[model samples]
Target: MHHTRLFDSYICLDPSMWWDNQALLKETKRALETRRFHGTSLYLGIANTADEGMDVTRVLTDTTTATLHMRSALQLQRYFEHNQQNGLKYRGKYYQDDSHMSVPFIAEYEALRFLFGAERK
Candidate 1:
């Protein structure tokens, strides 16, 4: 079961949901331009699903964010090697044997290691 499918029945029907992207982008640019660092840091570990609508290229452009691209998992493509080679603070890990729903088991572990500088066992 894909993660989104599990929540398919609970999607929001509110009209305000669509108003935020444009506003948010404008605010984000202003913040960035003003050098107002958000005071918190985040590491993104996207599954890099082949059909994902979010543009990986754009997301990875932000140097402050580190991403872990899952290469062999369902929904994602093989992106780890190229991204890693480019010195983008991204790591590639394989979960070739797991389904999308099962990826969290291994990915969560890898994410912790990536964020905390732990050695992989």
Candidate 2:
């Protein structure tokens, strides 16, 4: 999204935030802070992979590799929510019943609907 104006919309489902120490998250933060995506749209679909008893607050403090995935994604979700000045049409959906392995189909369907203004029937 930073390098291209070709694609006006983006859909990221259950990103692999464990890669390169979550460089994607860091880069996105910087981009959102510095760049303006006025005509672009971004949708982030977060999966619930938490183990028993681990909520958002609890997993946020955990530095383990297992929890980093969801934590990083959630951070991006919250960031997009709070920082809406960039004129980027952004939506973040948290699927509490979905796991990492089971989010793509639903996320893609919903994302497409959002991008195209399709109503659920």
Candidate 3:
């Protein structure tokens, strides 16, 4: 599972899931720029073939926006693969096995409730 925490929002994504990464990135950028997704921070937990997990966490403040935007752009570009002889195929199949490869969107407000042991808000 890939985890990203942006401000008050947390996203748990499966890398093998399929979606238009470019579109998502584009929308996310727009959201960030417009302050729609402000206070959003994200952590990406990448599991390697060696069975080791790497945590990639970033705080989505104005300072890191440019870097995150660049990474998102690259990820969007790599989401699809072109076989020299074949056509295009999504590169996110690894996370899609068993229909479990998808991102679960969680609001920060809800996370705060759970973190603080408060009643559901």
**What is the C-alpha lDDT profile of model 1 across 64-95, one tens digit per residue?**
22222221121122322222322223344534
Give the better candidate number (2 or 3) by lDDT.
2
Give me the overall lDDT of model 3: 0.31
Residue 81 Cα positional deviation in candidate 1, in Å, after optimal superposition: 3.3
Order of candidates by lDDT, top first? 2, 1, 3
Which digits, one per residue and each the tens of the lDDT, describe model 2 over residues 1-121? 4564979888989887667987878888788877788889888999998897888888789888779889888888987887798889988899988898899989999999998889576
Off by over 4 Å in 1: 1-80, 83-87
Off by over 4 Å in 2: none
lDDT of each: 0.34, 0.85, 0.31
Which candidate ranks first by TM-score, i.e. highest?
2
RMSD of each: 13.5, 1.7, 15.6
TM-score of each: 0.33, 0.90, 0.27
**TM-score: model 2 vs. ground truth:** 0.90
Of the candidates numbered 1 and 2, which has the greater lDDT value? Answer: 2
Worst lDDT window (10 residues) for model 1? 9-18
